[model samples]
Target chain A: MSPKDLEDRLVLAIKRAETQLPDDVVSALEKAHEIEEGSAKVQIEAILLNIKVSRETGAPMCQDTGIQTFFIEAGADFPYLGKLENIITDAVKRASSEVPLRPNTVNPFTGKNPGNNVGRYVPYITWDIVKGEECTIHLMPKGGGSENMCALNMMSPGRGIKGLKRIVVDHIVSCEGKPCPPTVVGVGVGGGADLSLKLGKRSLLRDVGIRHPEPHIAELEEELLELINESGVGPMGVGGKTTALDVHIEYAHRHPASFPIGIAVQCWADRRATVKITKDGRVEVI
Target chain B: MATVKLNTPFDKKDIQNLKVGDTVYITGKMFTARDECHLKMLELHKEGKDIPFKPGDMALFHCGPVVQKKDGEWRIVSAGPTTSIRMEIFEDEFLKTFETRMIIGKGGMADRTLAALEEVGAVYVHYTGGAGALAAKAIKKVTDVYWLDELGVPEAAWILDVEEFGPLTVTMDAHGNSLYVDLRKEIEKNLEKIHAKIENS
Candidate 1:
């Protein structure tokens, strides 16, 4: 209800996201570890061990604690909407020092770090409004290595879904080990260039293995996942059976002439956490 | 398949003996160097100025760590490898100029780095990506730090002492062998088939 209460809850949510892998992601990785062999198996084992150490010590899972990003779904009637931005920013500052997030934000021109993880438009927030009495916040701390692998393609509308599949497959293959496979591939189709990329990144917020409601879109996700894994860019790209843990696709209606495809890749760590807050000040973090 | 244990100030023979896929654990001293640290080190080399530490005596890690100062000591909270390919442009000269024998990072480096490894009798090992906690556990102490003010924490060169610090896999070797190169070729071949499957479907 109050700004301090909300900020404190956000800080704890960030700490959870940093130190613990979500249940879905952890289970998917466990499955990969069981199925892989040879060098790929070894890499997965190290990753599992790392996950254990991170959870136990409450240390960040990755050194690149990532640029802080929050996806907020707020009820139009939620009383604290006006103060949400400031509260979220303050939470980031506290989490940067307390959870000890890497100071990832830097001035593009001056190359100076304020060292608090707050800078021009950082702790980037994406907001959605709906009719409800609760605000739900999702934190996805995206690492730099995989973030660098994001790609966008503008294709002729005539190219169709086949062309989309080709472009996505080609991009992931070219990325090789750079994005840190076993990665989660998020593909955004049909939107304008910027919207496509945004949708692609937002699609990563979905839990691994959950399919889209539409049958056709769900099928596309399965096909893309199969093709990517078949590429043999396995765990950390050393070669294995599982190149990607999952593939997620989100789409929007396109203009007559242009089809833009955006690819957002997330590494194996795939750190994300969700918090739900009610108008009465009750908070729950997952 | 074999596991090798290496200490700092590695002998050329120890580096030369490694091949792709061999797991390695390292001990002794190392320095964290990321984009700015690499650039600054190269610039210092060009100016013929003294470097803060001896490159040949320590392993170079491509890392930007989360650190905290507690009780008057710098502590590594999470220290994992950054993607190595970003440093591809500087690595060849870095290896030749400093004769650094080992590189620890995630992802992989390019041909120039592989060639430099062959020429310099060095190897590039991969610490698992996102395994920062595991890495910090192996680091025994922060010996010193350089360029803290100029480059900030992640970009600063933090000198560290570590013990048996790795499940690092030798991905690039002094004999001009690279596991990444091999994987890329295989993936490319598979991509063609995947494209065909997409076309037919």
Candidate 2:
């Protein structure tokens, strides 16, 4: 509840984020490696090796350390609400310099910046208030390369599966080497613009091999995966069969005229970590 | 085999002898620049200002490094390669103006860029992206910097002394071979087969 405790928690969260790759992501990458065929097998192998090298050296997983994004779910009774926002901003500033993450945040209009954490809309923080007395934080270091490949649309429900497939496959194929494949494709369906985009990003947090709980959505995931691989946008977009490592989809209810779908492509590094803090002042790294 | 140094304006003989997957270690004055600097250089070229270094036979790394200052001098923080496709627009023209023979970056370019390289006898070398710390170790010294007063550290041109600077692979060679494009095609064919099997299964 105090400033010191918040600072320590912030520092701990940042370090945990830096050191450990998420278990779900790791598991997914392993599965991808297991089923991977073609020259892409080597790329997957190299990516796994890169994870090792990055961890051992304490360097970032990719040269593009990505824009720091935090998905924070906090309880109403959480002690540090008043000071938490500034604490997070300050922590991001400290971590950017200390973790020495690549200065990915830039001034969109001016196209120039201090090359530090200070920027408009930087360290983009998305928050959700909940009932519990604890807080959970999810950090994803999103790289520019993969972010470039993200796409969205409001499809006609009549356009159906075929239409959905066309947009996703085309966007990825067009991206080619830009997003640094073999990528993990995150698909969000049903929600409104912001929610659809959020679902697309949150879908990335799902472990690689796991499918949507709904069998039909999972089937769509599989089908899209096939369609994308068939496009021949292989590892590093060098024209391989393994255009995507996995495709995870999440959905919500949408307006009658809307079938909003968002796609967020994650490069191989897929850096993410989670931390939970309880009311008893215990911190758990997930 | 271990190390070699060469200056710009390489001849056809030099270009022909070089092959894909060969490791090259370059010496003699090299400049450190990335996307912004490249854009600025092109603008300068258009306006007919004195070019920084003769472009030929030099390595222009695709990087925007992090830097710090100590004792009133700029120093590198982490200098790693960025994906080169972001510079796709400027490369071909830049190649013609600068007699640069060795092009170092990650990912190979498309047909137009490749054509320019072959015409100019330039070799496109792929450095391991994300190896900023490792790459920084190769920069033996920082000689001088240009545009420092205006552009600031990471964005400025860092004239460097490099030794054994590369484990570079010729992703696109002077002979019109591109490992990345070729590899992608090979991967695509196999993927098609796998998809067919999945559909049948």
Candidate 2's TM-score: 0.84
Per-residue lDDT tens digits of candidate 2, residues B1-201?
222345444565776567655556666556766777887888898898987666554577777666656688756545656788767787878788776677777666777778788887887776654545556556667767878767765567777767766556566878887776676666556545654654454
* Leading candidate by DockQ: 1
lDDT of each: 0.91, 0.71
Best candidate (score: lDDT): 1
Model 2's CAPRI class is: acceptable
lDDT of 2 by residue, A1-286 (tens): 5666666667566655654566666666677678666334545555666566556656555656677788889999888766667777777777777776656667778877666665777778788999978988787878777887788888998877667776777677777767777788998888798788889998887777889999988898998888787776666654455778789989899888889989989977677777677889776767
User: Which window of ten consecutive residues has the lowest lDDT sum in model 1 chain A?
Assistant: A1-10
Worst 10 residues of 2 chain B by lDDT: B1-10
Docking band of candidate 1:
high
Model 1, stretches more than 4 Å misplaced? none
What share of the reference contacts survives in each candidate? 0.86, 0.18
Q: Where does candidate 2 stray beyond 4 Å? A: A15-20, A23-49, B1-14, B18-30, B43-57, B69-77, B128-144, B160-169, B178-201
